[model samples]
Target: MKISYLLILLSLTLGTPSQIDVSEVRTAYIKASGDEQAVEQLNSKLISVTTTDDKVLVAYKGAVGTMMAKYAKGLKDKKSLFKEGVSLLDYAVTSDSLNVEIRCIRLSVQENAPKITGYKKNIDDDKAFILKNYNSMTDEGAKKFVKGYALRSKVFNDNERQLFQGL
Candidate 1:
């Protein structure tokens, strides 16, 4: 009886899924743009997950999926990955339209997506939304992460970038 109980307890512990950290995801996202390893790491972490209930995680999952397209070998695979990533991202946005971080993630993807993908439609709207909502955000970590991305983004011109510089 004792052995069976111990085995069951061990199995239950091992079967529980780990919680993903948003801050860690944010850090990985920043590195993912320039690092293929970061992208791969994020992909592996988020690929099999199937729910968008956690909006931030789903958004990062989408962003990482989109970024993975650049590393894909074949054109078809590239398009498939990009499409899947964008689909997840869109779902996240629809689920939580007012989440600034989600909008920021979408903007990042849209701004960098190729014109051929036709995924650039939301750039202006997302950028405007982010700018308008940024200062009002209460999560300092999120604000800092978004500001860091904005500083390096091509869509945010000199004057626009300045808004994120001081604070």
Candidate 2:
């Protein structure tokens, strides 16, 4: 009975915004790869995830819209998604210059997206920003998450990877 209650309580508290874990969020994202339904569900969660009137919250919401665009096939659909995502990301970084995680999300989207979409323009600048400041992020989880993603990304060259790994 005690174990049952503990499990229930744990479940209840874990979903709360205050308890939201970004590392776990990133892990779940990685696990959901190639799973359409899982991606949709996770994207929905990102859209709904709460933040304290902060850039991270805005960025997550924007990222969800961007993910929705990823699954969209039409040119118009992708355009709409890109606009919302990029705008939110820009707003986030503008509001909080130190939001490396938010910038990471924006950079990832821009770097992988095609050049025709006009979203790739920030790829170099965001990469430079991330490389320059990521090591100094106070959040250990953020640092680890960014470094892991940057290492795997083709957008970052050997020098960038070396910088990430060195950190």
Best by TM-score: 1
**Whole-model lDDT, candidate 1?**
0.86
Instruction: List TM-score per model, in order.
Output: 0.87, 0.76
Model 1 Cα lDDT, one tens digit per residue, 18-82 = 45667888888888886999899877766545553488788888889899999999999999999
- Candidate 1: lDDT of 155? 92
Instruction: Score each candidate by Cα lDDT.
Output: 0.86, 0.73
Residues 115-167, model 2: lDDT tens digits: 77677777777788888888679988778878887998888999779887767
Misplaced by over 4 Å in model 1 are 1-18
Best candidate (score: lDDT): 1
Ten-residue segment with the worst summed lDDT in candidate 2? 45-54
> Which parts of model 2 have CA positions greater than 4 angstroms off?
1-16, 32-34, 49-52
